[model samples]
Target: MKRFLLFIVFAAFVSPALVSAGESGAEILKARCASCHDLKGPAPATIRQLWKRDAPDLFYAGNKFRREWLVAWLQKPVRIRPAGVNYLRTINSTPTHQEKTKKGRKYDVLWGAVLKPLKHVTLSKQDAGAVADALMDLKPHTALVAGVTLDTSKKVSLDAGEVIFDKVYGCTSCHQIEPGYGGYTGAELYTAGKRLQPAFMLSYIKRPKNWDPKIWMPNLHVSPDDLQKITNYLILLSKEDFSESN
Candidate 1:
């Protein structure tokens, strides 16, 4: 009878601790990621608000990211944007001496914090899986991605895709297709295939204002056929081995 009483006492003491230890993924995200990313949102209303943001919003993460990619990325976090989330904070407006040689053409260059290596929160494999699960649940923009259909039938070679991206759309002026290869004002395009969902990419490319009201990326009004080709090309490009070049 005394042993039975002792057993009940031990169970009462340990139950609370076990419950605390097994925290839900949502709780973990609220504790760790809520500070830097916007877990709850109506995206920034204006450019001023956009510039004020310190990190990317996570409220639409489910619609934007691939689950497997999110799981891996959370474990080994890296910078997706070369110029940081707010490029204005990292850019230097002063014209360099090299600009003098270019017929007095002034250019904004990335300096200060952006030139340094990216600093981000890293997670353990188990914690990363939990966080990814929580992020995947935040699909507020289902309507935006609904109409986007990735068509793989439009077969495009890498060379043809580069022509459309660079020569046709002039995307190379702001975004890089490879490391250190293109201009620096925008996010690197090389990793877009693996980092973002196909539907998000197509929808965003079709209309930038729908996703981000004040984003600088303009709506290029890409045709439906071209959009499919471009998306397919991005997916194909992600499979390439750029390690040797780097």
Candidate 2:
């Protein structure tokens, strides 16, 4: 009777601690984030599959984001991509009235839920920290960022960077340098440096399809020198305060 009582006491006190310790950041991810995001990914294999995606793939988030940025973003969830992750669902055909501008050219207009503010589930500071810790544990694409380093030696003025982004590469068509500018389908570029690791930015820009197989971003075949300049430009851009403009 005495031994049984002792065992029961041990189980009651120690088992709960064991269970709590086992309930890690990964469990938090599975419980809360797995519903909307792709926690396990080979990325979308087809355009149809890509269109069906509801949220960004978090499987490689540790490889992609800065931990500080992730914590901040989760606490105050905001729209990073002007168009939702699935732009196919958010975009509409050109309207008749606006089909032809004074230049008599056609253009597609944004429609649906994305035009409104972001509808993500906001987290409390503590929860956000926990979630960020969980997300940082996910690092499936480690090889992609290997040996990649930010080239700080290269220097490009903001104006020169804009020219490269807009004229040389035409990235401005899909990504925004400032709020209310550029296309609606891709992520905002102004904050890319702040949000992403330098290695990740370099790697992803080199080959986006490698990261998300069926993603809409096409390889622009940027040269090595231009790539260095572009990445440096993004870091410079991040330093500028965009609260007033954004």
Candidate 3:
């Protein structure tokens, strides 16, 4: 009877602290992140809504992001998308024909605010981990990742991966395979392997429209083999040390 009473006392003392720890992170997210991130469900419904999005949707972050990456990134927050979240607001078409390499082809390039360094909220290590934990609890798209799995056997060489990303799918036209080596419209691909869950990457690549119906990324209609290859390539690419040369 005495031991039972002691156990109950310990539980009473510890439960509240555990709850408070989780709540602190959630409260921080509400106070700071809710203003910019979409912690709630259902992505932008219309083109107008999509254009208005100032940050990436975090409603499905639990399923999308790798926890360690989230914790680290939140601490030293940097811009992932070179053109910012809404390229429509940052890109401008130059009037001069010299801006174009081909006749009658005007290129829209990033300008103004996007060209400037990113301004984002930074959190302390403790707070970042707490917030990442809270964010991980917001998973609503579990179904998206349930059936997907990474197939490492399908891995391709870095050169082969580059060929697939650049020539086959033209992903390099939007996403960067290496720093400053691709278009600024999409988020940098170099970090995708470390920052995102492999299953999420596979599912998103399989059908991006399912995640965000109005997202600008077109359905590439990737074959199953290519899907595995691409996902494997991304995972392998993440292991490279780009900092060595830089």
- Give one digit per residue, the lDDT tens place, for model 1 in 1-246: 999999999999999655644677798788778898899998999877998898888999999988889889877777767888888888877755223435766766677787776777777677678888888899999999987789888979999999988888888888888888887878888888998999999999999899888888889999888888888888888888777886
User: lDDT of model 3 at residue 147?
Assistant: 74
Clashing pairs in 3: none
Model 1 is weakest, by summed lDDT over 10 consecutive residues, at 95-104
Runs with alpha carbons beyond 4 Å of true place in candidate 3: 1-23, 94-106, 244-246
Better of 2 and 3 by lDDT: 3
Worst 10 residues of 2 by lDDT: 16-25
TM-score each candidate: 0.86, 0.86, 0.86
Q: Give the CA lDDT, 0 to 100, for residue 92 in model 1.
A: 77
Candidate 3 local lDDT, 220-240, one digit each (tens): 999999999998888888888
The lDDT for every candidate, in the order shown, is: 0.84, 0.86, 0.87
- Segments in model 2 whose C-alpha atoms lie over 4 Å from true places: 1-24, 94-106
Q: Model 1 reaches what TM-score against the true structure?
A: 0.86
Residue 15 Cα positional deviation in candidate 1, in Å, after optimal superposition: 18
Which pairs, if any, clash in model 2?
none
